[model samples]
Target: MDNLTYGIIGCGMMGQEHLRNIALIKGARVAAIYEPDAGMRAASANACAALGLGEPRKAGSITELLSVSAVNVLLIASPNYLHLEQLEEIARIRPLPILVEKPLFTDPADAPRLAALRAAYPAPIWVAMEYRYMPPVTRLIEEAEAATGGVKMLTIREHRFPFLEKVGDWNRFNRNSGGTLVEKCCHFFDLMRHILQSDPVRVMASGGQANNHLDEAYGGEVPDIWDNAYVIIDFASGARAMLELCMFAEGARYQEEISAVGPKGKIECLVPGPGRFWPAHLGEPPVPQVIVSPRDPKGPVMVEIPVDPQLLAAGDHNGSTYYQHARFAKAAMGAAPIEVALSDGWWACVMGMAAQQSAATGQAVRIADLPCAAGLL
Candidate 1:
């Protein structure tokens, strides 16, 4: 196939990001977008123009976008709660792949229904967990592989930006956003599963809503979701992880500066995200810094990994999303195996749900009980 045409649904902030990022994808192009809301529809047009792309041919509904022959893929960039309705439609549409946003569903209760709906689809559906595509993060995986002791532990104080406050939406609420554990931290859980190469056996978490009290003062409903959470993930490999969450990072929204203590060495990923994006804004940047500080029996040594030079410039956030899109297109073309397949997404959701269930029920949820795909995505 010359190009994998994608039909995007839900034209929101992330949708606009998709509009621009898809331009860089060599194997695939966003063929159309469907919003259904007049406000978002107009916004989508403005976004297309900003990207120097022509007006998006609007679809009256999700069904219409799937009907477009050139649009061989469905990108469900819609809000968290609005996913199930679209995924059900895409499953019957054709051989198209559906790329869903994170958290999978609005509530854990919908997991089985979504899976049953997906079971009927003759096509593949994947969740858009793009974090694993981060070039430096990928390098972290390589570094873990090269080490004889393997990754024994990691600690990251992940600070997030106030996007919900700026953008204004459901991410501010606990229910519609599927609570904090599933909504924001699902990506990290998936990334952990990808890097550790081991499924978490148990998750115990604790937190309560605190930061969004202004909602009540503004006459907005108080969200029940927790603003901060401390989670402990016990992986099958005996490598346990502790996650620190505070959505409002002091200087940046995200900062790992992770310190992984392995038997042979102590590897730290202190890569700053803002500095990475600043270079993209200024059009001056180099390869990502994936430094490994190894304290081997031979003494201390630092190693910096080198990835494909072209990837270094494209801003890892957008680049990783674009890379995953390209990879999906390649998988669709039968040129490569799907890295983040439907099963992968479902498993990620199961993991997140397990954590959520554990958090809500105040018990340790076991990964073994979560459903796994008996077949393909």
Candidate 2:
């Protein structure tokens, strides 16, 4: 594995973002891409050219992309519903090192299928949870315990723009995206588990499509994707976590504000949304920040966590995609261990599903009772 040649499936907006970040790596290049949409294919080609990387061979299908001899690794950035079947196809055709996007599977019924894939897949499969690598969030995770003296409560609040239009607008429907909790809020759930260092025992949530996409109808059907939610989770370690998400509040200065508190004090991180969306009049977007307040001091100390300009230009995730790709590349080459494994991805997805279920039924959902929790527990 002298160099990594990527075979990319679905070169849409997210896939193109991956390409930009991959260009930043020394030994990684996309060898081939499988994008069904002609417009997206053209856009991806233009993106590669703009990045000064040689144009990747356009692949008509996933099989064609996988068959490319130079393609030693894989990436799946397709729609949520297609993820499981695509992974199954990859496993059957060629089990190459893969980095798949989050919310591993959309349907709860597919959990058994995912479990089977997890059991038999013969290569490293890194789930893309880029939020974990965000500079501010990473800082919070690293210093939470020391700052808070063992975190007893954690809160993550995300107030940002609604879902961007994707190819075919597949994101507008719950059936396709596994509901707002699973599709968009999975990152927060994963963060809750990761930051607490414990699995969730139960989930309670109240969310609905209060705004955005309410009047928009595609093929005579209104969009059912939710725009806001509040989820409370009880962890196995006796810690409690809450998530507050509002997709219509894009005017806020910060997109994500996370805080953890304990008997000693509190620690919080403020992360801005994508710099591209920041109004030009506001000058540069707000720099990521971590604030620590110890009980003894009673004063808060805030530090700015700035990401590299080049990395920031590469993706909307505050340079997390680049960092995640760098680590995934190493894990693929056996130089590093997989930080976000199949189990981790499963737990994240399961938590989101449970949250949605709790919201829908107006009752708390027990994580242990979910069918997907069979082997995960």
Candidate 3:
């Protein structure tokens, strides 16, 4: 069809990022935005004008945005706590293609409700898990899948700056973000599941809020979000994954690193970020590379990292966001399939919740025991 118009909810950091990337997407334009904060609405409108995408209509509320008949899709980038509610509202209004940011719901308790809602509404909902689109990470998935014995072990590490300041500083609180794992590590969890091709069966984790946003109070409310966390997950297929996340590591060069080992060989990747927007690359940017040695030992054959030179210069998490928006536009127009499905998003959130539970109680949480495990398996 013609260019699809998307109405955005939130208009914060991620929303603005989508707006910028949508400019690069030929078949999509942000037609309306519903941000409660007037300043954010103005800023988003200014961005639209600056990008030459035309001024988007300012929507006062979700209801108003839904009322806009011109908008063909809804892009929900709101705070974590508002995800399910907004989704339910959108489903109630009409069946529109939706692109919701990762960690679909803040709390695991909402999982059953979400499932029930989906059964009733059955709208085409796609989750935004951009890590799957990253060039190096995508290569890792390819090598792992092609390996002789499959990926046996996976490791993800993120040492980067503290939580970015969000609108109203909502991200600083666990009550709003659903803990550090759900807020931040969902991307990694999603990636692990995608590469391993298995649903997580159990999880154990440990983390604490020490040196980050909690040091000070915002309007008398202390931030409860943890600054560091380590999570171990056992998948149903016997593949295992471990995550090490530290938000307090200042000046660390590679903000994120990932390694995977299979029965045949291994793959490693480092992502230079948290400062990527400046130079788009700091020093020598880590490229996605792989070394594969079969059981007979081909003597460690190295695989070249796949990168689009155009995307490498476009910034935004190695242009994953740009590709994601382009894919979203195509999917909305029925020209392509949704790469990140709703079930994938749900499982990632469920795993994050399981990790949060295990960390809190110092006990291993079985994925089967979680409330959200009903229909997902």
| Candidate number of the best lDDT | 2
lDDT of 1 by residue, 1-377 (tens): 66777788987767766666666676455667888668777887776766555556788887787777788777788878778767776765665766777767766667677678757766666678987776666666667656536877866557654434313456667667777777777777787777778777888887666574445423356656566777889988898877777755635523554556677776555444534434345453333455555665554454544444444443346257767777777776667776776666666666667667777789887766655322222
For TM-score, the strongest prediction is: 2
Better of 1 and 3 by lDDT: 3
Write the residue-wise lDDT of candidate 2 on 71-149 in tens digits: 8999999999999899999999989999999889999889999999999999999999999999989999999999999
Q: Which pairs of residues clash in candidate 3, taking residues 3 or more apart in a chain or in different chains?
A: none
Order of models, best lDDT first: 2, 3, 1
Evaluate model 2: give its lDDT. Answer: 0.93
When 1 and 2 are scored with TM-score, the better candidate is 2
Candidate 1 has what TM-score? 0.84
TM-score each candidate: 0.84, 0.98, 0.93
* C-alpha positional error of residue 86 in candidate 1 after TM-score superposition, expressed in Å: 1.2
Candidate 3's TM-score: 0.93
Which has the higher lDDT value, candidate number 1 or candidate number 2?
2
lDDT values for all models: 0.67, 0.93, 0.82
Which clashing pairs does model 1 show?
159-253
Cα RMSDs, all models: 3.9, 0.9, 2.3
By the lDDT metric, which is better: model 2 or model 3? 2
